[model samples]
Target: MTTALWLLLYGGALAWLAPPVLRRMTSQGISPQLGVAAWLATVAATLLAWLAALLMVIGATTDSVLKGNVVTLCLELFGFSEHTPIAGRVGSIALIGVATLTAGLVALRIGRCLSRLRARSHDHARAARIIGKPTAHPDVVVVEADRPAAYCVVGRPNAIIVTSAAIESLDQTQLKAVLAHENAHIAGRHHHILMVLRALAATLPRIPLFATARHSVADLLEMCADDTAARRVGTRPLLAGLSALAGHPAVPDGLAAAGTAVVARAERLVTPTRWYVQWAHRICLTSVITGMLTTPALIQVLCHH
Candidate 1:
């Protein structure tokens, strides 16, 4: 197959097909970190494949400008029968402009998002301190609020907030679970993880790849924390805490917890990943990651076709 068709297979079709499979793997009760890695691998592969295709398109256009015959060659290669000289030349030039414009816009958007997230993180850390007070837990702070609220603000002196309602509502074991859960957030460095992915997503909000990546990573991070907390304090403690905090407010941007996945986390803890499912996740992800790492080299070699 020509490079264009190969690009479509890897970049266009495979990108859309892979996300669901990754999501399914996450639900298999396998290793959450591995699931997160697979999600990252999938998105990186899709982005790299699309980027390779874009470079190829631009290179072809450049070739047409200097080499003269590249336009006619590509038109015939792709079976474009409306292959007038004027049409071929115009198409290549137009593609060059479009690719340039797209790259510029994506760069600008990513820069703006990173700037905003930095500012927000600063403000969020400040506000969390004002609302909460120092507790025995060096990392955690408790605030007096009637409504239930629990969230963490990232960076040094990270805030893991617990509301009056949360403290009053939960038993000693459940409260320990909450602390363990928030502590897991700090240890896992989920805030930094999500922030980086969010920056990438901001660059290409129109693409499903970014959205799927952000969600999948965030969810897996939460699961990883849950696993840690469970092993430390037992699953029942985290499970009860999550149940009581079901209707609580959402965490600040860049923070993750058992907030959204209360039911899912509970269910997962009840069941275990079968050996077959674990092996399947490993096998499939290894295959995709290998393909992702190698495909660009192969595509580059065949690009002249």
Candidate 2:
């Protein structure tokens, strides 16, 4: 019981502390990819710590047949006391029921979110294909809208939708840069990342971390795509294309070329920071990830025995 309490505290502390540190590290020029990894790892570690603590609590109270022996053996190995107070046993049962309910709700919420997102994406892509003209490139199509929009819809054959106005606005090189950005989004499977984060955020609105992380990861993924596009087509062209498409409206269930943190991304390209491959940045990222994950595991084990 004491060990479980400590583990719960540890998880809470990590959930509260990690976001600021991860945000700072990303701002300090760690690559968006590493930033995403660090954030996701922190979230996972916190959840794992809580889950392990929950299992420990249940093990202390449960003496049922099939699972009881295994849990009892593990608890004994960890030096957990055999006898739980009557009150503690009752509390553990309640906690188990609550956890089960919460898991079911989260699963349902995520399922609904995924279903809606996929439907919207498919519908939008189908509409775009019907109305938009094909380009020289196999992956891109130009829509006849005056509003200069460019976003990619994920599907069987991922499609990049660019407005005719945008095509007219940008030079050939700039246009290619925009296409490259959309291509990067598709190639990176960024939609999957956003979908998971967004679903979690929607499901756990009370947990500010999920909401914060969803927004942060969305921005970072945009930066990741930006970096790829910049490398494919030079920064100058990419920057120009982004400028041309500034204030672009985001499409539902779509990754827009210039829809996320445009000013920050542009600044980054203009005054490039140290790349993630540098030893210094790598060390910083490695340490953050290790410390965040290891601390929780250590607490779960060390606090028990």
Best TM-score among the predictions, by candidate number: 2
Displacement of the residue 154 alpha carbon in candidate 1, Å: 1.5
Best by lDDT: 2
Relative to the true structure, candidate 1 has a C-alpha RMSD (angstroms) of 3.6
lDDT of 2 by residue, 47-166 (tens): 787777777666655643223332222344347656434434445467567766776777788899888888778788887888889988977889998888799998767789999999
Task: Give per-residue CA lDDT, model 1, range 220-242, as digits (tens).
Answer: 88888888888899988878888
Off by over 4 Å in 1: 1-5, 63-94, 199-203, 252-256, 301-305
Candidate 2, residue 122: how far the Cα is off, in Å: 2.4
Clashing pairs in 1: none
Could you tell me which residue pairs clash in candidate 2? none
